[model samples]
Target: MKRAFVPPADALIAFETAARHGSFTRAAEELHLTQGAISKQVRQLEDRLGVELFRRVRQRIVLTDAGRLYLHEIRGPLLDLTAATRQVMSYAGSEDVLNLAVLPTFGTRWLAPRLGDFQKRFPKAGLNISVRLQPFDFGAEPFDGAIHHGDPVWAGAIAEPLFDEEMIPVASKVFRDRHDIATPADLVKAPRLQLSTRPLAWRQWFDQAGVAADTAFQGSRFDQFGMMSEAAINHLGAALLPKFFVRHELAAGRLIRLFDISIAQRSAYYFVYPENRTLRPVVSTFRNWLLEEARTERTDPETMLPS
Candidate 1:
C-alpha cells in the first residue's frame, strides 16, 4: 500500500489559521507573518492537498466546504499541539512550578485570604506552600521563594519588600473581661500567650505601656502565630501579636485590642526568591500584585495612622 505525501507542519498551520479566520491578512497578523507569506503558504498547502481550500468573494476570502471540514478536524489537534509546544517552551525557559515558604501566622491570617485572587489571575501556575521558621538556610530548602519577616539576608537571592509589621497587644473579649485589665500594670497579672520568635514581646509591650511585668511571668509559648491566636481566642491569655496577623479577627470582634498602643517592629516582611535565570511565572505576578496592594493600602485613609 502507498501512503499519501504529507505537507510541512508550517504549511498546515498557515492553512488552518487562514481557513479559520477566513482572511489571510488576519491569519498573517496572528502568525507574525505578512499577508503574502500566509497566502503563499496556504496556496502551497492547497496544491499539496489537491483541494480548493478558499473561495474569493467580493475581494474577501471564505473557506470552502472541504476547508471547513478539514479545519473542524484539524483545529482541535492544532490547538492541542500549540498548547503542548508552549508548555514545553515554558518548561525550558522557567521552573515547572513555584514553591512558597511562609510564616504560618501571616499565611493564615493575612496571605491565605488573598491567595484566591492570585490563583484566579494565574491559574496555570502551580503554587506549593510550606510553613517556615526563622533563621532558615535557603540552600538547604526546596522553597523557590519565601515570604519572611525582617531582612532575608540570604546571599544570591532577590528580596522585595512586601509589608511592614507592627506589633500590638490583643486579647479575646472574654479574657479581657475576666482579667479586667484597665492599665499596663494590670496586664502583668494576666496570663500572656507568646510567640517563640518574639520572646520579649510581653516585655516590649509592657515597657511601651510604662509598666514592667515580671519578665519571669510564666505563660504559654508557641512556635507559630496560628496556635497562639487560637489560644487567645479560647481565652487562654493575651498574646502580643502583629496587627496584620489579627486584622481580620480584630475587625470581626473575635479579638479585641488591650490598648491603643502600637509599636512598629524593626522587622518587616519581604518576599525572597533565589536569584536564578529560570524565574517562576507566579512569583512575578504575586510580587507585582502585592506591591500594588501595598500601594493602595498605604494611600487608603482607613489604614493610615492619625496625624
Candidate 2:
C-alpha cells in the first residue's frame, strides 16, 4: 500500500489566506508574517502540488483553477480540524463530553427536566446539547448522537425508539372563548397555525377530525415548536402540537385544548447514533439512562381530553 502525500500545514494556511485576500501582502498582514514569507510559503505549496495556484493579474492576484478547487475541498476539513483542536485543548483534563443534537422544543420541555438526574448519576460526564431540527449526517457533524423524530431512516445510524407522540390542537383560552370553538368543525373558522416543516399537519388534523374546511392550510408558519407554541399562547392561532410539548401550558391553563381530538403522530422520537461510530462511556451511559427515563414516564391516558 502506498502512503498518501501530505502538504505542510503552514503552506496550506498561507495558500488559503492568500487566495481569500487576493493579495499576498494582505494575507501576510492578517497572518502576522512578512509578505515575502507568505509568498514563499504559497510558492512551496504550489511546487509540492505540482500546480500553479495563483496568477499575477497586474497588481492583483487571482486563484488558478486548481487553487479554487483545492480551496473548496480543503476549507471544510480545515475548519473541522481547527474546531477539533480547539475542543481538545479547551478540555485538557475535563471529563468526557457527549455532544447531542436535539429538537428545540423537546430539549427544552421534556429532556431538560430529566437531564439533572443524568448529571447526578454521571457527575464527571459532560453533556452538551444543541438544537437540530432535522436529521443530519452523523459522519459530517461532531454530534455523538441526536434525538431524531420520524422514522428510523437516518442512513448508517441505529435508532432506539424513545416514545410515540400524540398531537392535539391547542390555543389560548381567550382565543377559544372569543372564537366560540365548540367542536373540531368550528376550528376552520378560527386561525390555524402551521409548522413550516410539517406543511401537512393541519391537513392531517382536519382529516382525522373528519372536517373539511377551505381555510385549513391558511395561517402563519413557524420553524420551531417553541415559537409555534408561543404564537398559539399569544392567541395568534390554534396550533397542532405534540401533547408532551404543551403539558406545562395545559396544566397551567395558559393553553386550552380546543377539542377532545388527539391524533397519533405518524412518527416517533428516537435516540439515534451512527452504527459504526465508537461511543464514549458517558454517551453510552446517557443512552441507557434516557431509555429508562422514557420508560418510567407515566403512560398517556387512553383519551387526552380537555378538562
Candidate 3:
C-alpha cells in the first residue's frame, strides 16, 4: 500500500508563513524560529515535492503558481486545525464543554433570554457558542450540536423538534401606506423581500391568502432573517418574517404586519446534535432544558412542543 504524499506539518507551516510574509526572516519571527531554520525547512519541503515553491527576488520571496495554489488549499485547513486546538485547550481537567453552532438571530431573540435560567440550573456546564448561517457536516465540524431550522434530516444527527414556525408578512408603516398594501394580493406587484433559505415563503403566503401570485418567487433575497427584517423596517420591501422573531418590532411600531395572515414555514425548528459526536452529559442536559424552555415560551392553548 502507498502512503499519502503529505508534507511534514512543520514544513507546511513554514511554507505557508513564508508565502504570507514574502520573507523567510519575517516568517521565522512569527514562528519563533531562526531565519536559517525556516529556510532549511522550506528547502527540504521543496526537495521532497520536487518543485521550486518560491522565486528568490533579492531579499524578498514570491510564491510560484504551484505555491500559490498549495497555499490556498492548506491555509484554510491549517486555520481550522488551530481553532480546534484552541477549543480543546479551553477545557479544564475532566470537565465537559458543549460547543454549539447557532443561527445568529435565533441565538439572540429565542435563546438568549433563557440562557440565564440554564446557567442557574447547571452552573458547571460550560457552553461555547458560535453563529453559523448554514448547515454543515456534523462529522466534519467540531461542534457538539446546533440549533437548526427545517426538517429533522441532518445526515448523521438526531433532530429533536423545538417548535413550529409561522411567517407573517411585515413592512414599515410608511411603506405599507405608500403601496396601500391592504390585501395579500397587493404584494404581487409590490417589491417583495425574501430569504434565500426560504425562497418559496412568499408563494406559500400567497397560496394561503387565496391569491394566485405568478411573481411570488421574484424578489430581492437575503440570507438571514435579521437582515430581511431590517430591510423591511427600512422600507426595502414587504417580507414574510417569523412571528416569534418580530413581536418586539411590531410592538415598537418599527415594523407593522402588512396583513393578519401567516403561513406555516416549510419545516420546524430543531435541536440537532450529531448522534455519535460526543458522550458528554451536558449535551443531553442542554437538549432537555432547551425543549422545556420551548414548551414554556410558547404556552398557548395548543403547545408547540415536539409531538
After superposing candidate 2 on the true structure, give the runs of residues whose Cα lies further than 4 Å from its correct spot: 1-4, 57-59, 99-101, 128-144, 152-158, 196-200, 203-218, 221-223, 247-256, 273-280, 296-307
The residue-by-residue lDDT of candidate 2 on 1-307, one tens digit each, is: 3334678788888988998899999999999999999999998888888999899898888998998999998888789789789766645555888889998778989999888888888878876678898888988888899999899889889999988777889999899888988888888888889988788888888998899987878999888888999999999989999888898898888898878777777788899999997888878998999899888653655334566
Give all TM-scores, in the order shown. Answer: 0.61, 0.76, 0.80
Question: Candidates' lDDT values, in order?
Answer: 0.77, 0.86, 0.85
**Runs of candidate 1 exceeding 4 Å displacement:** 1-96, 134-142, 278-280, 296-307
Across residues 83-151, which tens digit of lDDT does each residue of candidate 3 receive?
888887767642678889998888998888778998898888777899986778987777888999878
Model 3 misplaced stretches (Cα beyond 4 Å): 1-11, 32-37, 40-52, 64-73, 130-137, 183-189, 210-215, 276-279, 300-307
List, residue by residue over 1-307, the lDDT tens digit for candidate 1. 3345667789889988887677888999999999999989988888888898899798689888998888888879789788657645654534445667888777887778887987687667666677886646667766777887877576777778766677878888889889888777888878888788777767777778788677534688898788988899899998878777777788778888878776766778888877864565566776787787766544543223211
How many clashes show up in model 1?
A: 0
RMSD of each: 15.3, 4.1, 4.9
Count backbone clashes in candidate 2.
0
Whichever of 1 and 3 has more lDDT, that candidate is 3
Query: Which candidate's TM-score is highest?
Result: 3
Cα lDDT, model 3, residue 258 = 72
